[model samples]
Target: MRAPKSHVRVALATTLLAGAALTGSAAAAGFAHADSSRAGDANIAPVGRADLHPEASPLFSVARRLPKVSADQVLRLAESQVGVRENGYGGGTKFHDWYMNSPRARETVARDGGKVTDYRNAAWCDMFVSWVGDKLGIRPAMGWDAYTVSHASWFKENKRWGTHPVRGAVVFFGWDGGKLLHNIDHVGFVIKDNGDGTIQTVEGNTGNGKVEIRTRPTADVVGYGYPVYTA
Candidate 1:
């Protein structure tokens, strides 16, 4: 059979609690112990919290230091990074390989150290975002799973992604492409909004190629979440 939605919610909640504890960051999104039973029960209303920093210019400064990367820049990064590999799903693609193995993105994170980029792992997008969170000085950003769980809770409760992209918006992708049962495997930052329903992002493990920017269709986006990276 399949795990009931309630079980999934409980598992997700447990993951969030453990993740938050590991990162030593307090739950400020007002989602602490969110009752998943209430999820999607109604059209969500706008909810805000002090933990999530508001969008601002300084948030984009770190990305600007790079080569003026835009949506296209991110797309090129993804295009160059896409990899054909054998995975649990048989011949599959691995998008996060670059964060661990790529010399360019790794070098950027190593040199910057919580300033330019944070590279938690050379090959995982979650780690890449964790490093980015550190560069931006957000403590909870370190826990890859927590970041995801928190965002999931936020979405389950709020019903809409935040207004604008910040440094650490939880970028979610379908594990098997819209198969919610697979859980989310990819996450990253919004490098730029093309303003035409496309977004450029810098993510790790985009593939064996390298840590780079890539573009994906936002029309089918399942989730867009943000984390408190700064005060």
Candidate 2:
């Protein structure tokens, strides 16, 4: 149901990012991928990889550049991708290409037990989240992972987990609707609390296989992950 980015995602981003610090124009944040020949994304610049690994940056990857990371930045970048659709074949988008090419794909496959190419067409809601942060050069604070459960667990382990919706929180969900992280089936970035028991969100791999905005009930949220955004 949730399938994936393909070509023209900008030339620089064709290479594997692998938690590498990213820098370049805002186009690098596009939701699609550069073609195999490095044609780049048609609508956006692909996020280029910097030599510095994620471990090296820890949490201030964007701090070195913007010095003031905000949820709005994340929202804007995510919102810009609203109409992005996955390749109809289900395995050909840039998100898949990016993740597949990454060293993290191996780590994830080893931990999750699968071949790296299995991710070529895997459910990509989490990958979408990872892509957004990676492009923003905030993966250190934003965190990145392919599985929703592991990603949510990371937030808990880091002491960045919380209840209550806040603008920019990473919201984990259980389709059956509850607070059990293990039951979490999906994830998205919070846009705002509607005060109607729902929150507006921007999500990838949703709505006919395209990135789209959604209104979800709080009852479905397991918890929120707070990133270390600058004040």
Candidate 3:
């Protein structure tokens, strides 16, 4: 028997509404699942730190604090190379190899007009500074110019140039009476302030072609190039 048309219409409308409700609930469940997955991902830690108990991790101990690569580390690294010596006039193969292999060495060579082999038999005071900066991961801020004049200019341009002595600062020298940016002849890392108007520095390519720690009066220092190191 055929039902009334109004009755059939009401039944059809009811079915459509029921289907829409079910579709909305499913969409909400999918959204909730996605949110839960994101929350789980957020709880995950770095690989090495995640496996260890919180107290067992090396980062847990204050006594076992790792030294960050900063100014202090740079000074220490430079000091460690104190006994390194050149074989002859402009002959420090170790220093040369370090400079040659550096990421910025080619740029330095191009700017300064020197070959990789020439560095082995070249003035390497600047090269030593470049090597230290590269090793410490501060090359972008410290610069790796093969010439002191060029390095000094970079410092001045970047506003890292200074005068007062600070540990780990690179000290540029100018023996000639002219502008420091133009006359810079050598560079080194400052070790101490000396507290008496002088600074003790660890310099490469000094005194018989050997790395040496020397004391220099502040008056003789042209200026200092400060690296952007972590405080």
Model 3 Cα lDDT, one tens digit per residue, 1-231 = 011121111111111101122223534433212232223232222222232232221111211122234677888889999989987776744877786675445544444454555555667888888788767655654666556666666555544567667778889887663544655667898898898988899999888888999998777788887655533
Best by lDDT: 2
Superposition TM-score, candidate 1 onto the true structure: 0.44
lDDT (10s digit) by residue, model 2, range 101-190:
876676566555657787877887888888888787677567677777777766665445678688888888888766776667788999
lDDT for residue 103 in candidate 1, whole number 0-100:
39
Q: TM-score of the candidate numbered 3?
A: 0.67
**Residue 191 local lDDT, model 1:** 61
**Better by TM-score, candidate 2 or 1:** 2
TM-score of each: 0.44, 0.72, 0.67
User: What's model 2's TM-score?
Assistant: 0.72
What lDDT would candidate 2 get against the real structure? Answer: 0.66
Task: Evaluate residue 86 in candidate 3 and report its C-alpha lDDT on the 0 to 100 scale.
Answer: 85
lDDT of 1 by residue, 1-231 (tens): 111122123334333221233222334432333333433323222224434332221212212222222233323433444343324321122323333343333333332233112222123455445444333333232223213433454343332244455433556665455635235546666666678877777665554534666786664345666442212
Q: lDDT scores for all predictions?
A: 0.39, 0.66, 0.59
